[model samples]
Target: MSQKKVDAYKAEKANREKIMKKEKRVLRLEKLIALAFCIVAVVWIGFSVYSKVNEGKEEVVVNTEMDTSALDDYLSGIATDAADAE
Candidate 1:
C-alpha cells in the first residue's frame, strides 16, 4: 500500500480507544435522557389517573325547590294595576 494510506491507518488505530470512549459516553447520556422521559410520563399518567378517580367520588348539591311566591306577587300586582287602568 501507499505510505500515505499506511500513515492514515496508523493514526486511526492510535485514536481508536478515544473514539470508543466518546461513543460510550454518548450512548450512556442517551439512555439517561430516555429513562428520565419515561419517568416523567409515568408520573404524569399516575397523577391524571388519581385525579380522575377522585373526581368521581365528589358529591354535587343541587337546589331543586321551586319557590314562586315572589313571581306570583308580581303577577298579582300587574293584574291589579291593569284593572285600575281600565
Candidate 2:
C-alpha cells in the first residue's frame, strides 16, 4: 500500500476515536448531573415532609366538663337571624 494512503487511513481512525471519546465524556457528565439533581430533589422532599409533620404536632386541649348552653343559645340566635333575613 502507498505511504500516503496509509497515513490518511490512520488520520481518519484517530479522528473517529477522538469523537467517540468526546461523546463518552459528555454522556458521563450528563449522568452525573442527573444523579446530583435527583439527590437534591429527594433531600428537599424529605425536609418538606419533616417540616409538615412537625407543624402538625400541635397540642389541643379539651375540657371534659365544658358547658354547651351558651353555644346552643348562640346557634339558636343565628338560626333566628337567618330566618328573619330570608
- Tell me the TM-score of each prediction against the true structure: 0.61, 0.51
Residue pairs clashing, model 2: none
Local accuracy of candidate 1 as per-residue lDDT tens digits, 1-86: 99999999999999999999999999999999999999999999999999989986968898899999999999999999999999
* Clash pairs for candidate 1: none
Model 1, position 53: C-alpha lDDT score: 92
In candidate 1, residue 74 scores what lDDT? 100
Model 1 lDDT, residue 83, Cα: 100
Show how many residue pairs clash in every candidate, following the order shown: 0, 0
Judging by TM-score against the true structure, name the best candidate.
1
lDDT of 2 at 66: 80
Query: Cα RMSD to native, each candidate?
Result: 8.7, 7.6
Error of 2 at 20 (Å): 1.0
Q: Once superposed on the true structure, which residue ranges of model 1 sit more than 4 Å away at CA?
A: 59-86
How many clashing residue pairs, candidate 2? 0
